[model samples]
Target: MTSVAVKARVTGRVQGVAFRTWARAEAVRHGLSGWIRNEPDGSVRALLMGPAASVADMVRRMGRGPGAASVKDVLTERTDPEPGVSGFRIVG
Candidate 1:
């Protein structure tokens, strides 16, 4: 399994809908390590790190966040994984 990292920016109705919390839970469930945070521009940004397949799955799931969220778009890009980061969390 190839480990990979992905950076994603999720837009539209993502903030104030428990998106970060939900993402943390999802990442943990998938054994991913990274962080999710709310951007000042009202978008949610996340770094997903794990096996390529798991990260891909997480990205797909992020496209449709919690029921309260109305995700308009999910933009993703491959990136270097964070060093020494373990477990998922909500960060500023």
Candidate 2:
């Protein structure tokens, strides 16, 4: 099966809510490989790569985020994976 990668930007009360940690854990649970981090503009940016269905699910979860996160917008777009990317990371 072909895997898919997507760039996701979650906005609204996302910062300071452990969003990255939550995403990293969820990605691992979903058997996904990618990364997540806090954006300077008060958003959470993430990449979810795995089966198309899994990636889609990840995006949906981003919309909901953790209970503490007030997700206002979950914007996503198809993207290419970085060379040799593996595992979910919470980057600076």
Candidate 3:
């Protein structure tokens, strides 16, 4: 399958809202590999890598986030995939 990687930056009510945990679960459920983290700028950033379709789906899901998150924007960009990444997780 064609694998791809994408970095997504989520803004608006993303911090301190369990967004990282929710993102991790979504990535795992999609069998993706990468990481999600809280940025100091009050945004959530996530790198998603997997089958092209799965990555796209993950990005879409991030737009909604958890119920506590009032996602205002989801900015995404294609990036080089990390070959050593395993399961998804919350990272610093």
Candidate 4:
């Protein structure tokens, strides 16, 4: 599988809803590596790295975060994976 990376900004009821935790778990499940954080704009930003398909799947999952989260949209961009990055985490 070809490794790839993606940067995503998820908007709408994403903050204060365990979205970051959910995203971390999801990324790990897909064997992705990167970080996620809460944005000042009430959105959640994440950088995911993994197999191309897994990264894409992670982006799709961002559209439907934790049950309490009402994800309205997810803006994603293709990017280079962080060098030597391993494991997904929540960045403070």
The whole-model lDDT of each prediction reads 0.95, 0.90, 0.93, 0.89
Checking candidate 3 for backbone clashes, the offending pairs are none
> Model 3, range 1-92, lDDT digits (tens) per residue?
99999999999999988899989998999999999988899998899999999999999999999999999999999999987889998997
Scored by lDDT, model 2 comes in at 0.90
In candidate 2, stretches whose alpha carbon ends up further than 4 angstroms from where it belongs are: none
How many angstroms is residue 60 displaced in model 1 relative to the true structure, after the best TM-score fit? Answer: 0.5
Candidate 1: give the clashing pairs: none
Sorted by TM-score (best first), the order is 1, 3, 2, 4
- Cα-based lDDT at residue 62, candidate 3: 90
Estimate TM-scores for all models: 0.98, 0.96, 0.96, 0.95
Q: List ranges where model 3 is wrong by over 4 Å.
A: none
1 against 4, candidate with superior TM-score: 1
Which runs of model 4 end up more than 4 angstroms from their true locations? none
What TM-score does structure 2 among the candidates reach? 0.96
The model with the greatest TM-score is 1
lDDT of 2 by residue, 19-85 (tens): 8888899999999998898889998888889999989888988889998889999999899887788
Give the candidate order by descending lDDT. 1, 3, 2, 4
Worst 10 residues of 2 by lDDT: 76-85
Alpha-carbon RMSD of each model: 0.5, 0.8, 0.8, 0.8
